[model samples]
Target chain A: MNLGILIAGLLTLAIYSFLYKDNPVYRAAESLLIGLSIGYTLVLFWQSTLFDKLFYPLLREHGIWLTIPLILGLMMFSRLTRKWSWLSRIPIALMIGAGAGAAIPAMLYARTLKQVSATVHPLIMENGGFDISAVVVVIGVLTTLAYFYFTREHKGVMGKMARVGTYFLMIFFGATFGYTVMSRLSTLIGRIDFLLGDFLHLLK
Target chain B: MNSNKTRWIIYSTLLIVVVLSYLLGINLITHPSPEVQKSYTFIENLPESSVVMVSFDHEASSLPEIQPISLILLRHLFRRNLRVVGLSLFAEGTAIGYRTLTKVAQEYGKQYGHDYVFLGFKPQHISAILGMGESIRGVFPEDYFGNKIEEIPLMRKIRNYDDILVVISIADGDRTMQWIEYAGAKYHQRIMAGLTAAMITTYDPYLASGQLSSAVGGLKGAAEYENLYGRRGMGNRGMVAQTAAHIFIIVLIVIGNILYFKNRSKGGGNR
Candidate 1:
């Protein structure tokens, strides 16, 4: 346990050192992480999809039909040989085509139609209540959307509105940036805390 | 000339104080435990034994956020005796989500087919979702563990979105919105979303529109869930770290503004 803790603490410090200066230690840790992830993903893809969906079905009942994907999959590895790499395009094309076919209609309905339609309504209080939040949201959405209008020129009232929209866009963008940074920093902190708290037992 | 050094010392001292305050206990106290209250209200309202579609639509990178929610919600559902069918829009979440689901389900003595089933991920995400809406079995011919759909008793009963009483989409991107627009809007699956805090406001419209029944936003949302389940998990820890980090950033920003004003007052060389 002592040895485990020491090594973890060292690795955490090593990775964190990248923030101060770029060096071989950080590079080695980063590369190892990438390699391990790739190795793990291959094993999972085989166990979850290839073995369960393809292999098991072939051996039991589906037989020849399953062989088609298996052979096409094997053909994919032929790209390792420079001369035969072109042949791999056949399977890749089919995969891309199927992916595109799936994405297009779904993107149209889910993203284009639904999202735009969702933006059209502003909440209004029925009787006594006032929807202040909804009003602010409507103003924000319209302004932000207008800020993205590059095809037209801004002047007078239009220019002022566009400028106000730009401010809202910046705040939104800044908040998003802040959140993303926090999320990433939390991951880094987790690793560091493990090194400090659990691995090093320093904090404890 | 001496004041410059004194100013530096004062700034660094302030930095250290803020950091210490944030790290030690200040943050935990400030960030209220509203998460528990919100999640409790959500679960309390949901009907017992209702079929719910659990979209574990997150990558391995987001396991920190997605995993706890998966475990806690799984326990909550199983304990409530609700039927769950799991699917992932993201490739990386499939395996991680499966392990989490199985681990929690086993702890609760929940049987796989009788209580929950994991319909593994498909690369054709939009097509897969549309297919599942049309036919659940057609989209996932077998469960993640390679069990046939027919053999899984839970899968046998679940046919489409309409059968699902609630749709819980835990995601890092607009994918949750996709589920809301497609399944929730089209099929009227009572929807709830759990998303990264940063991305939550983007979906506020959906929440206000009544498209989403409720939402658990980011680590706060997860923490709320852990509170409701009466279990301390990653979210609570994350909130601690997040609170620390936010305070750090806020302090940095203040220092920056001070430096700007100070330089302006002195008429510094650099513009």
Candidate 2:
């Protein structure tokens, strides 16, 4: 057999071995994935951020102004040291604060306003007469939302409503499960296609 | 009449239905050919050269499902000579999307910047999203390759949301909703989503109510997109395997059920 086939077979074996039971081959592949990811991220981050934003300005313009970010970046490395670890918080805090500040208002509008408004759309049709589908969708949205409406006891009439909501929730979950199954099956198919169609060229 | 027999019957019934459905292509409703209908509607509705933001919001993990849709859509956009601005919501998707976009753009002889641009992954998702609307250049000062955004031909004329016609998010998260509120509602930019099959139903209301122009959900949707573009990619390849796998699972369920019911009839223990 050719080297190419050998390598491919080994990789397939390594990946599929996880099904039978976890072993050293799986561990090796998993570790390699982590290592490769970190390495790739470092390269990308350096290319996109550090080299572009940091070194390019300094090198192209000979600007001493680049010292600020350079210093801040160096400070980030200080987290590795036992004594200077506390200094890492400045940049970490800034990143977190900025992330939270950005997420809050955007989430407020997107999750609260747009999602709620989208849920509350006209259930009955206007020009096309009545749309049962639209009414069903609206009810589905409300009931599914109600399924998660905790902080109140779901007892008696409220309990019945919650149970009704739970039914809607189950339908939603069934739909989700169906889609997820398709997606996962697709992934397996893609891999098999690579092995069968692309590589082996079998059964054509 | 026994509890065990009833459970076995339910399991076997479900198995038979699922297998029959897949093998026969039996669907309850003939889903409107999403491939043709959605793409045609999208192309005809949006004016030529309109700046459309396409987010590669999925990862390599989901490439099996998402990449085919990404390629066909890119082909459509490029074929129509649309000014495509690509970004990634998930970091893992950055390289995958960039590679796919570059390959498709090259196929159509689309020049970078003049026809399409990869903005890469915006660091802060929501802020960067809002910032894109507020000031396109300020949020992404440079292109993925580190070229200044102001100098890039694709971005030069874009001052803000006025130039942005559509924001297409293909994500696994609720970030699509973020785009709707921040860009769609805030700037009235037409939004579309190409999402995993699993996330489709939650956003169906958006598609119906005119909040989103259109969307393609999961591998089947991706396959539909591929069919429209006149190219069969991994999505179509995957369908064969998916149908086969579903059949396998259904068979397993049926066999398991048969074993259960037969054992139960013999007064065998549940264990």
User: Which candidate number has the best lDDT?
Assistant: 2
Cα deviation of B190, candidate 1, in Å:
4.1
Q: How good is the docking of model 2, as DockQ?
A: 0.36
Question: What is candidate 1's TM-score against the reference?
Answer: 0.78
Residue B74 Cα positional deviation in candidate 1, in Å, after optimal superposition: 2.7
| Stretches > 4 Å off in candidate 1 | A1-14, A47-102, A122-124, A192-204, B1-40, B185-190, B210-213, B264-271
Candidate 1 lDDT, B1-271, residue by residue in tens: 4756756665455445433433464224323344346555667667887787788888766665556566777778788888888878776777777888789888888888888888877764666666778888887887876688989877777788768887788888877877766676556667777676667667766665566677776666666777767776666655666665677668877977888888988997343
Worst 10 residues of 1 chain B by lDDT: B26-35
Over A14-70, each residue of candidate 1 has an lDDT whose tens digit, in order, gives 876775568999999888768867876677667656876688879987676888899
lDDT of 2 by residue, A1-204 (tens): 567666765676587677556799988877876787778777776776677667987989787888976877788998899999988888788778977876677557755676677656565677857877667767776666666789778778667777878898788788888777776766655555556544565624
DockQ of each: 0.25, 0.36
Error of 1 at B145 (Å): 2.7
Model 1 global lDDT (CA atoms, 0 to 1): 0.71
